[model samples]
Target: MKKGLKTLLIIIAVILVITLPIISSYNNLVSLEQKVDQSASNIDTNLQRRSDLIPNLVNTVKGYAAHEEEIFTDIAEARSKLAGATNVSEQADADSELSNALSRLLVVVEKYPDLKANENFIALSDELAGTENRIAIARQDYNKIATEYNTKRRKFPTTIIASIFNFEEKPLYKADQGATEVPKVDFAD
Candidate 1:
């Protein structure tokens, strides 16, 4: 009886020793993934805030530059694309398009000094700027957490566990092409 009890105890200890690290690793991956998801949501929230601010800004500018109907149409289309974007890449592209349109709108504003000086336009611009900063910070946080999760999932023992659990790699948010370029606004038109 003593020998049998000792064997059972040894088996239990071995099972725990084998399972504990796997459990710990899985829990850690789950936590990191949740953080990444939350950070991504934060980006979406800030983007929505900016989107909400755009209509007011557009209206304010429209009151002054009603003749610039083409730029306003471009802004509307870009805003719609951004609203319909399902993922990071699509959102980035749509965001770049919207930024380009806004740049042209700014040039139009330059032509109308009164719009730039409008109190409503100034307030909306400030709000949009703040939201852009929030989006940037959120993207940075998401990338950092995603990098950590990806690294952890790719490591030796964790890699094996990750594969078994289907812990797919998280994608980093990248800016769209031409996003860094200053959109040229032609005054000659």
Candidate 2:
């Protein structure tokens, strides 16, 4: 009976020795996932800020150029796409569309010096630019965390734990087409 009890205690200890690492790995994955989520939320917040500013910008421009209906419609549709996005992939797609629409709107503005000079439009433009920077930074941070988490999830031992817990892979923000093209910043008058 004493021999049997000793064997049982050894078995229990062996189980714990193995189970502890699994628990620690699982916890690290969970923390990494949470970090990715928080970073995504940061991006969402900035995008929302940019979206919220669009109305003021659109209306201010409308006051100067009411006939530019198509641009306004395009901008509205892009904003809608962004609003309806459910995840990082969807948001990236919509974000690309919204950027295109905003670019077109800017081109339209170039036709009207008065609109370009409008203080409200200028302020809104600067604010939107800053928010875009913040979004880029947040997305970079998210991608880094996601890559680390994905690596850990796929690694041996942890892979088994991750699968059992259903810890799926997170998506990364892919750059839009033509995003790599350098803009020609000519200062020549």
Candidate 3:
């Protein structure tokens, strides 16, 4: 009976030793996943701020350039794409599209001196530019966190734990096409 009890105790100890590290690693993956999710939320909030500013700018420009339907249409279409975006990757793509459309609209505005002089249009433009800056910063932050979390999930023993928990690798939020172009902000004078 003494030998049997000793054997049972040894088996239990071995199981605990084997399972503890796996459990701890799984917990770490969960924590990293939460961090990634929070960062994504932060990016979304800033993007929403930029989206909210578009309507006012569009309306202000429309008041002055009623005949510029193509520009307005482009802005409206881009806004719709952004609003319907389902994920971070989709949002990045839509964001690039919106930027391109806004650039085109701004080019049209160059011909309208009266629109340029409008106080409301200028205020809205400033707001949009500021929000874009915020969004860019927020996107960088999110990407950093996501990279860390993804690396953690993919590394060594953590990868085994992550696989057991079905933790898939997340895609990085990359800038869309033409994102390298310097933003035009000429509120001076």
Give lDDT per model, in order.
Answer: 0.88, 0.91, 0.84
Candidate 1: lDDT over CA atoms?
0.88
Over 1-189, each residue of candidate 1 has an lDDT whose tens digit, in order, gives 699999999999999999999999999989988998898888888888888888999999989988899999999999999999998778878888887788788788888887778899999888988888898899899899999999999998999989999999988988766657875656685
TM-score of each model, paired residue for residue: 0.91, 0.91, 0.86
- Top-scoring candidate (lDDT): 2
- Model 1 residue pairs with clashes: none
lDDT of 3 by residue, 17-130 (tens): 999999989888888888888888887888788888888888888887889898788878888988899987888888888888888778777878998989998899889888
Clash count per candidate? 0, 0, 0
Candidate 1 weakest ten by summed lDDT = 176-185
> Could you list the CA RMSD of all candidates, in the order they appear?
2.1, 2.5, 3.5
lDDT of 3 at 30: 82
lDDT (10s digit) by residue, model 2, range 64-163: 8899999999999999999999988899999899988988788778878998888999999999889889988998998999999999999999999999
TM-score of 1: 0.91
